[model samples]
Target: MNPPYFSENSGCKSPDQSALIARHEVACNLTDISKCAAYLLKHSGRFCLCHRPERLCDIFEALRKYKLEPKRLRPVVQKDYQEPWLMLIEATKGGKPGLKIERQLIIKNQNNTYTDEFRSLYREFATF
Candidate 1:
């Protein structure tokens, strides 16, 4: 609605529960996001999201709490030798549980070079 009207607030804006809930954890957290997704998605509907790699447990915990079963997961790394900085996941609302974790996706090489696969993946957005 109205292009979402992105605004300014620290998620701690006074007298604005909606913005607070949306921007900060003042009234919301991963659980709230999962609940909102649960409300918006139909049974068996698929929901996917990308998040920081360190929050895997939080994401999984919240999704399960909302009856959303994680189906697939992929780690996003900048180099083959480094830890993942991002993670991608797909879940099904009210579906049976069976988490399928894919192999780590190495975005770059040891020398900070973009791998062919990574370049292909982001070809449209890459500059060189």
Candidate 2:
């Protein structure tokens, strides 16, 4: 036998129309003006890490198209910091022309603190 229709169940009065009305209700509840604006900004692809004047123009265009004021969007600047690996490389190559290579294994504890154990290897070409 074919599966029973969902509308024929005891609670459903008008299955087709009831489903449509339920969908409209869900959609209405899910719509938030601020979240919609944020989604538009993310999807525009005009505002990203490329710090160019022309890209700023494109971002302004997207803002205009969405009927949003340009002043509402604030630009955030991040300071670039050197990574530990680069620092290690710089220290290794500095004064001594031939030095040993060393590595440290870091372990994290349950309290979110770290402990390091050092290991050393000799390198003929590395500056100490």
Candidate 3:
């Protein structure tokens, strides 16, 4: 569930409705998504999603509100020296209050080349 990362009141509107829905909270927000996940998942089941780093606090609050405790987080960074641009999160239904923050996943090297790990992860996919 790569849910919309933007707040409905925050961002500029897009003329493209599809793109707007995909990126903005036109249909559902994080709390709504988290609630659905909490309802659907069984005990110990994992709910995974990729989202913007800034929404981390909101995500945590939403997950907890619905009893989906955040268990793991993997920060995805463009370079090793930079702060995370994206976050890969895993929450477990009825899980305890423990969070395991994994190592940062660097997307590119200092020279602007894609990192080996990034390339390997998408090796089977077609690039535009």
Candidate 4:
């Protein structure tokens, strides 16, 4: 699904909207590293729109030979998952890993139960 932050369609003129979108999509779809490298040359700034700072450095290094600035876009720190506990962790890595460990245990248990139920269902269906 197209992210809500990006426009549903590329309609902006100054940004070369349609071309940018098409190039970005092509870059994202590319599987081969060589193809990705080629796509990056033509559409290097597209990642900036998504506010991916980590990717910016890589893009910069790639475009460096060409003397390209590769615009510095502001990082979009997603507020959707923001919580007091996450804030605490960000403040200190030494904080208890209780929540993360508990979540992992719950997920593992649920997955085990799901696998067992699926196996039982499969066996029952096979007899029928």
Which candidate, 3 or 4, would have the higher TM-score against the true structure?
3
lDDT by residue for model 3 (1-128), tens: 78888988878878999989988998999989999999899999999999999999999999999999999999999999998989999999999899999999999989999988899898889472
lDDT of 4: 0.31
lDDT of 1 by residue, 14-106 (tens): 576775545445555677678989999999998888776756787889899999999999998887878887788898999898999999999
Candidate maximizing TM-score: 3
Model 2: residue 3 alpha-carbon error in angstroms:
45
Predicted structure 3, TM vs. truth: 0.91
TM-score, predicted candidate 2 vs. hidden true structure: 0.20
- TM-score for each candidate, following the candidate numbering: 0.73, 0.20, 0.91, 0.24
For each candidate in turn, give its C-alpha RMSD to the true structure in angstroms. Answer: 6.2, 23.7, 1.6, 18.6
Residue-level lDDT of model 2, residues 1-128, one tens digit each, is 01111222224354577564443332322113223454555332222121222234543444345443333222221212211211111111012233233332233334443322211222343333
- lDDT (CA) for every model shown? 0.77, 0.29, 0.92, 0.31
Residue pairs clashing in model 2 are none
* Model 2 poorest 10 in a row by lDDT: 85-94
Worst 10 residues of 4 by lDDT: 84-93
Residue 91 miss distance in model 4 (angstroms): 32
